[model samples]
Target: MEALNQPLQVELGPLRERMGIGDLLRYERLAGIPLRRRFFVALTGVLLLAIAMLVALVWLDRTGILAQAPVLGIFAVGYAVLAAVGFVWYAIDLTRRARLALFAWVNGWAYADSLEGTRRPGSAFARTLRSRERGVVASDDERLPFELGRNFSIGTRDWGATVQRPFAFVELPLPVKVPHIVLKNRRRSIIPTLGLGRGGARMELEGEFAKHFLLLVPEGYQQDALYIFTPDLMARVIDLGAGAEIELVEDRLYVYLPGGTRFDRPATMEATLRLAEEFQRRFAARTELYRDDQAGDLAARAGVAIGLRGQRLAGSGVSLMAVAATAGVLLLSAGVTAFSLFGGDLLRAWGAG
Candidate 1:
């Protein structure tokens, strides 16, 4: 209620000539804190650069008046580039905020520039996997929509360090929990591993799906996985994005795009949202409703906080093949050492014979 009442418009446009007090008062009195912070940072950078240029100009007097043009031109170009970059960033961010607002408004859901009161400590996905910086979620609607985040960084220092990616997903409310399932592209070596990257027991689906993607599911859930991802759904998923990887952990359907993809563009956002929405709709009937949902309903009535859903896939759960390979390596090493030690004696015996 308070968020809605706070201020009505973003008010980016202007066509005023000595605007009246009433017209001026209608717009929000103050810009948001983030805009102010950005302005301050840019201002500080320009000021520091100007001071440095002035000091350099005084100290480097040997250049004479003739060389001043080139030197001044360098400084001017530097400043211009900095200012242009700042302006571009400002324009992009402002447009992004407006689009987010429009998305929330059209869907009749509340929007926040940051996470909205969701603190899921127990969940490994939110607590560990995804970054918590400037995540936006739209909830308070019947649909219980998705959280779209830009520049979410995840990964270890060893595995290419911190990689930023755009993640857009909607949580599928599964009444009966399901096993983890993943569909990855087959062509490229997506993961950096010594040998083959094991992703649990491979669940091969019918038709052309196998040609493009390799589906992996937990041991017990192969049959259920087949049933869950029907032939029609498989075709639709393929159509969604050929390069993207789709994952199912418990209840959530996640479409993970390659790292370094940006969601600021309308086309990108549209495609992401369209695919996610399709998945949600397709899986709706399959998720069997349970009486346990009432606990959530009761909590909602009681105003209890909701934790973030853990989408860590329980992992591929490691591989016995990897351990087997390691053992094989050790045996080969031992055999090589034995040959190295015994070769002299064997060679001498053969010559004597």
Candidate 2:
């Protein structure tokens, strides 16, 4: 019995290591309904309701009561109710899924950021990977560096403009067989479809945003072809030599590379690790340079600082007011339609003009 139990215990260890609290929550929420399934369910419900309404309209016409004022009024009210219900249901369902996706994306990015503070120097996790080549910086009162990268060009604009200087740089040597690569941020901020040009060849990367740092990898790189350094999770690109095209998908701060051939030997890991280390060192240097440049720019602009906080607050208030006004209009329109159909009959029956 002891011998048999030993093997079972060993098997369970790996399973337990793979399980996490976040995984459980995600499983619970996505248990039965997939994104595509939810969309289909809502679409089918609306189509069925439309068909039923059409059938009812046809029946009313055949009965020669389609033009009867009171009857038409009732039909209009019923139609309005159906429309409202459908709209509400669709909106609720869409909002729920969008919220879920956004939540997951943000949580993942936060996790990566937290890891940044905990990373040990000379450890894999502590070092920046080649893909992240960039970092986001922000101030307490105003200005965010990430927004500048979003536009990918320098110009003066609202929301507090600031220039970024590269503090460090990291470079990865590509395998002759690997045609495309991706870079990802743990925050999933980098767009995947945007290809980075290197040596006149466009290298594609997929981004993945997680809690500590952004991850980048060659798009469509095989699962088995990549590995992280021990105790660090600093990702590496394993060279498979040949066969299959690489693809990238970028989300948040991480990139996913898939559709690559497998690595068969320890030698592959060694070669990849070497490249990963070099890339990491370069990236750290680049970040330092960027921070230094930004600090200087901030000091210069300190004199020009005006009441930006107040402006932001006022803009937010105006936006809220507009949203409230729109909602009020929609509600008023719906209420008027309802009253016109239902109250019209009540007034006529009471002999009111």
Alpha-carbon runs more than 4 Å astray in model 1: 1-36, 40-44, 47-51, 54-58, 61-87, 115-130, 133-137, 154-166, 187-199, 258-271, 289-353
Write the residue-wise lDDT of candidate 1 on 1-353 in tens digits.
56543422222122112333332222112223354445445556766766776666655555664275666756755775676677657545644554555455455655555553343321213322445434253444334345545334354434232232334434444444445566766753232212222444676666798887876654445566677777887788789867766666555555555544444455665666676566666766554531223235665577532212212333422223434565789999999999899988999999999
Worst 10 residues of 1 by lDDT: 8-17
Clash pairs detected, candidate 1: none
Report, for every candidate in turn, its global Cα lDDT versus the true structure: 0.51, 0.31
State each model's C-alpha RMSD to the native: 12.0, 20.1
User: Mind giving the per-residue lDDT tens digits that candidate 2 earns over 219-252?
Assistant: 2322211322211333322222111111211111
lDDT value for candidate 2?
Answer: 0.31
Clash statistics: count for each candidate: 0, 68
Best by lDDT: 1
Positional deviation of residue 116's Cα in model 1 after best superposition, in angstroms: 10
Cα error, candidate 1, residue 2 (Å)? 30
